[model samples]
Target: MFQPLAELPPPALGEREWLLECHCARPVTDLLKAQGWDVVADLDCNVHCSSPDRRVYVGLLPESQEAARGELWHIHVTDNSGTRTWRQTFGADTPAQAIAGFLAALIAFPARYCTCA
Candidate 1:
């Protein structure tokens, strides 16, 4: 007979966990997935959402660089027509905050910035 090991709890808010470390990024990705969008959470912690038409791609970079200035996020919308719009310095107080902001944006105006249009 063997005993079970002690359980471990998740990290605290201030911990430097990756944006997509667990299911933290699921809310946004799940929504997009339900809408027939292809969502990819890359190894670098960035997420990409694309439409079935392959016309538009929405990329969310929570923290591209480790050593930099402020805690910034880069969000961009690109299309095959060469039309692109981006925000290179969307500041966030923390990774959770960044995920919240990005989720809010996607929920509020997905068509405006995403292929959901």
Candidate 2:
């Protein structure tokens, strides 16, 4: 059985969990997977989305599931891009704190040579 690890606490008001990443940072994705996050699906981030870049991501499944109803998340990182985006599912009380932490870590660049836009 897989166990959930201590992570960026759930957003203060939502149902999503967030973690930031940067071009040079080693994403905690593997760590999450080790805990319980499963890659349920692959994604084409550039397909019909406002994002101009392309990326391959794996969908994350939460530790909890209610009749197959749960949240999904995706993460991707590129070197020298200076930016990383975290797409997650949030409910009425979005995990704003965790999300903010994720944003802070995701946007932190070596020298401000990247962006999400």
Q: In terms of lDDT, which candidate is strongest? A: 1
The CA-based lDDT of model 1 is what?
0.57
Error of 1 at 54 (Å): 3.2
lDDT against the true structure, per candidate, is 0.57, 0.37
Error of 1 at 108 (Å): 8.5
Query: Tens-digit lDDT track for model 2 on 47-110?
Result: 1111123332333333335214634333455444545544444331334344334534643443
| Worst 10-residue lDDT window, candidate 2 | 44-53
Show how many residue pairs clash in every candidate, following the order shown: 0, 9
Error of 1 at 41 (Å): 1.8
- Which stretches of model 1 miss by more than 4 angstroms? 1-23, 66-73, 85-89, 94-117
Tens-place lDDT digits, model 1, residues 1-117: 554455555558788565543325565566667778798888877777776665445555665662145534444555557677443444445454455455556556645444655
Candidates in order, TM-scores: namely 0.44, 0.24
Off by over 4 Å in 2: 1-71, 80-94, 111-117
